[model samples]
Target: MVGIWGFIPHHRVLEEDTILQQQQEFEHSIHKSGSESDVVESIDENTEKNDKEILISKRISSDNEKEHENENNLEVEIQDFDVDYDYVPYKFGEKTYKIREIRDEANRPWWKVFDEFEYRNTKSEAKSYKWYKWFPEGTSSAEKKLLVKLDIFLAFYSFVGYWVKYVDSANLNNAYVSGMKENLGMKGNDLINTQTVFTVGQIVFEIPWIFLLPRIPITYGLTIAELFWAAFTIGTYRVKTVSALQAIRFFVGASEAAYFPCIHFLLGSWYLPHEVGRRGALFYIGQFLGVLTSGLLQSATFKNLSGNGGLEGWRWMFIVDGGISFGVALLAFICIPGTPAKCYSLFLTDDEIRLARRRMKKNGTDVNQSTKALFDLPTWKKAFSTWHVYFLGFINILGFNSNNTSSGSFVLWLKSLKKYDTVMINNLSTVPPALGILYVLIICVGADITRKRFLFVSLSFLLNFIGNTILAVWDVSYGAKWFAFCFGYWSWSQSSVFNPLISDFFRKDTDVRAVAWMAIYIIGLQSSAWIGRLIWPTTASPRFHVGFSTCAAFSIGFAVFIGIAYFFYKNDERRESLENGIYLYNSETGDIPQFVLDHPEFVEKNRYD
Candidate 1:
């Protein structure tokens, strides 16, 4: 007794009346037609047959009238109800979806909508474009819990691992300036040579380590590398010649080379593009803290432990830093899980593991592929052929070079001042990197909110250019020169942003992502080895005008490269959209056609801006 207007009680009573009226009309028509067929005896038999025929017609007419009334009611209801004009219904196969309409207001330039403050306050709208879609509205409570666990377990280790790596590497500089030079009879540029040899080791082992990354569990690999490097760091205390120290440093660099790229790759495997930026920044913050701690440790050890147990203060620094590294290595073995699909952490439940795998797959991760393919020639070709590889690689090189100027020149300048004691010099050196930590944290949070990687990177280069320009002049007041030197560390913020940006660019290709990350470190380290020594030579001392000027020019070049890379990224996006038949009226809202969503490879390319 339900009408098409949806279960109307009054319509059920009215329907019975309308059915009876239709039946009466049908009987009248039938009787009128049969009146001409009447004869005496024939009419008697025909009357009985006519009665049966009228009953049949009455039932048929009643059913027909009810069906017609239902159709009319449905039509009236549909026409009267309000529907959302902003959403268009699309049907594909057995499924239906409501696609938000693309509006004209969403077509504004990226720069216009690139404010972090505004993006934080604004809620995402249905018909508008979002700069980042990693954390869309309607994310379940389960997903929020998973992200928190990931930050606690996976992100925490990455932070500690990076911290230990930087502290170990920087110990050489601290040791050399403290007492290693006097103890080991090291001469001009010998310290630089040791660092250069270490960089060479990193370049040599880069490819081999990347190949090994996928074949072995990342946690095991990281732990083994950490243990070996820790041993080599302990060996540094026994070095009697520059060659001995150089040999130890080389192995240290080789073992540590895998740590950075593998950590970045692991982060990408677990987190979405939007989430990876902040995590990557946190990892770099570890490096800043390590640098800061090394300075303070060096200052304290020089004062308190300089002659304890017949060991030089520099030797004790090596022993203590190495011991801490070994302890962290043991902790990493316990805490770090490899990847979502392969995670063996005791902290996770079965349901959480399944949820993690499903979420990563939805985000376009291919967990089934072999990590060993990182060395395949075709995979290498695919990675190298991309324009992003060259442009981003060059940007990393410039960034590392700029960072080296801060590490080398600032300490040398402090040493040349001769006003502060060794302890003050070491303690004072921590200030710039401390400022760098703040800069990196703020910029990375903004980048995540605004989804503006290239913009922040450009700004980092500008800061470097300005800071270096002031240092190159070298004629300003002491306070002015000091401020300029400290400002240069702001360039380090680019480190936190670049890795996540590259990961986002190559998200669909795991092997390519691994190779690209390796290339970044290899090129950066190798370039820094040669370029760092030339820019901050022993002869230059307090004011390396030539080196600072060269770095300033490189900073401008880095900014230009970033612009070109962004242009190419947009071009690729547009070309892919056209080839895939994804028509877009504006930058914001658009129909995500079923065909594109069904294809696994096209999912990220279509959805990500």
Candidate 2:
């Protein structure tokens, strides 16, 4: 019992200020050692020459220079147990101390080189202590195995969900011309409005749900949302009026609002930075898989299910899709992890949880405190202060344009062409979107390995812009139009970077992190939904050239905007690192990486800072 209750000596909850002060002193020391630190900035002759300094805090110290630098280094080596002598506390509690690193001329603290456990112990200890040893809850072997399985499962589930959403949206177009008009008496843009309404639903509830998701069981909220969409999806089959269809679609949209944000939060909870992108791509794969599945399924069943048991093929599509959603939702509830502490049920051990906490803490995101309040002020200020949020919004509009004009309506456009048989059209349709999934994986993996994302995202948007341009100007070959369709799928690849970027923007503020993420989704999602309607009107059916052109322009415009924002934002990551007191070293150059995720203590620090 003593082992369970008292595992270690009194532990200090390392607050953000302590972290920030340590980082500041570290940076100051780096600045002071002009020559020694210069070694860190050494040129890599093989790589292209760019003036970007990746990290402000991390630097390479040559082994030869180590002895001399170590001697000359004015910073004291604060032992893990020596913080009481080095730092003066601003506040005092039995389990806490407002600690500061001893500063020198360069403001480098003696504690910079200390390991996190040592650093933490030097400053404060918990109110109680235990002489007994306590074994962690899970074994090392179990933790490793659990993480791999969870990673794969998360990737697969997310991918499937994305596929379902996109495939379902696209199928509406296929149904519209496959006798949906005659069966339902639907006319004009009412078809477009359904898609528009869905986007609005996504926009309206995304932020609130994201804010609320982490507070409760994630599986519970996600399952409820899925159920709503599933019910609406089935309800769509019964709609005989625009009002009826609109109402059902609106509810469906609301149901889906939580899916993206919720999944993102889920992914973040389980994976580290390098792991997030590829895992995210798994979700995008769902879009690709959904597209493939829809085409194949539609080709096989459209004719047979056309009049099966008093339901048209189109009606069957909704019923089947909705049913699948409901089933998947049920499965997800049983599988998804609620939080890191409890993930041991998924086979993780107590040590892995400790390591996970330490890893995230070292990565600069503190998950120790209540995540509910992370979005309060400093985080929102960080989120809203930058142009990245607005750029993300515009990019979302670009994504909406691509999804609406090409993805949602591609089948109808092909039907209007009268160029190929159902199988041929279905097969041809798969190419463009399949390329999109490919591009998303390639870009995400590249970003993960290289530790650079914004540049690749910009380049992808440019490629999409070029693809849309060809579709807009050249109409002679069906091949050129086909190329445009493929390019449109890549548009969502740009969306992949947005979430990761949001993670960076608020890496310091835990209180408002969830809400900040929700704000990001709301702005990008809602604005773009309306934009999709404005660009692709119902009247422009058969050929959505104008809409495609508008999409191209937004895609290009957003790319350009992101580029400019990148320039202006110009790697304040070191500043944030110092402000947060964590080192996320760039693996390639051995410098601190330019991107930072929020620490969990941003809210509490804000009031005092």
Candidate 3:
């Protein structure tokens, strides 16, 4: 039991500061650092086609005086972090951004001699915050070129991949309400049971991928996962009983379990902290559209294709959804840009690859983790030892449960009325997720513009709690209930903010980041499996008193826990700054290398900082 619970320590939790001094300090610093933090963008997408539109990288000069004298390389003048010339802001006309250059030659095997990253400096942000400038401020031409390719290949892939998967998931809900329950003779709690089985399968299968990813090639891992999801999704069309539906759902869930967190890690591996926000937002857009598309698809199919091939509309939905999933899987084979260090994309150049690595290093992102460390007992120990794992994992559970409305509660309510056709019901069910797009945009855009991540996140949860509270009242007016349903959907999507926030928080340890990402869905989903079966059985849907009450409590938990986590994160950053004069990014992760996955180096690895 001690071994099992070792990750949780008494010191991990923070007392709500009566004075809230830590909160004050963090908010103050974020304005300065976060403005320039994860928000940088790629240079002009069109102008850099020939790569001539770049700020040329000069060769490292043997004489510091001569390098500074060069006219093309503007002499940088900044007030922070630059001691011994290592942390210097670079000049671009009248505007300059904090740029740090670090050189460690002992183990530097790459072509670039020094790693130069653009530091998130608020000093320049005051002047640089333009309402209209599209590119990241003070970006190098080479860096811009890389961001364009990454946006094209990886960002779009992130959007499309989640879009197809969610479309299928929402299809499951639509099918269940449309005709599958009647066809399969699904009785009390059967809908919840099917969902529970999928959660169980996901939890069971997620463990291996969490451990195996860094130890295997990216292609092999993606192929296995996609094959499973595609086959099981297609198989669902043939299920004759609830048991068969549950069985297929389980395998489909298990196969695709690693996707959400893995993509998050992939994004964090390649992009800066500021870039992550909008990219993460784009990723969630796919999900919203997926849910929305599922409804529209069901409506059209029921009207057009039902009974055409001795198949119900729900069955047809599965066949079409599965085909889409398979097609997206093929796209993944080509477009999945492996980690920045080991990127094997056909769109990137050698210089752009190096630029990607430096950008990550600027914000202390670890882009060079060794696969050889996978087996080290200390590596596993470092991953588990941090408060980050427990704090972040549990916070995600609370966040997800807070948002989970079982059996598509809105759909269930519409179904209960017995007044709407399949077409109207499907269309009505989409309102919450559709409005959610705007809600998410408001929150994410606020966080990006103000550089206050925790502020928006806490506000998101507070509103989530309010929405669930209204639903629990259940005796309210009809229009009010509709308002509650729509209100909840608008506030419920915080995973986008949380994804990059968690990535930025746990940036140092790659294993811990991966594990925390895994915990978000793995452990969170496991708890959900039990909750769905017992507390939220469809028999009680549309007015699940216990479930709604539970959601309300967890929503508050989400707020409290996130606040506590933020306090500690800032506290750590504060202490490190005080001790070292400035926070030093000890991050070391690399792009995916060929041999790291197949035959890891057995070199003795350093313990996690």
In candidate 2, which residue ranges exceed 4 Å CA deviation? 1-146, 341-345, 369-391, 402-407, 421-427, 579-609
lDDT of each: 0.69, 0.59, 0.66
Across 127-152, the per-residue lDDT of candidate 1 in tens digits comes to 23244554556556666777788789
lDDT of candidate 3 over 1-609, digit per residue (tens): 112334221111112221233333334444435542221222244444334212211112222333233312322231121232333443435855333322111343452211111123322333454434545566555556677888888889888988888887888789988888899999988888888888888889878766765545564467568867887888899999988888889898888776876788788888765567677777888888788889999998888989979999889888888888888888787777677645555556544554565566655566654344444455566767878767887887776677654457889888889999889999888888888788877777666655567778888888878877888888899888888787675445677777888777767656666666665556676777776566677888778877777777888898898888876776666443312223222325544433223322211123111
Candidate 1 — which pairs collide?
Answer: none
Model 3, runs deviating above 4 Å: 1-85, 88-134, 490-492, 578-609
Best by lDDT: 1
Q: Candidate 3: minimum summed lDDT over ten consecutive residues — where?
A: 9-18
Listed per candidate, the RMSD to the true structure in angstroms reads: 20.2, 16.7, 17.7
Stretches of candidate 1 above 4 Å error? 1-136, 371-374, 405-407, 578-582, 585-609
TM-score of 1: 0.75
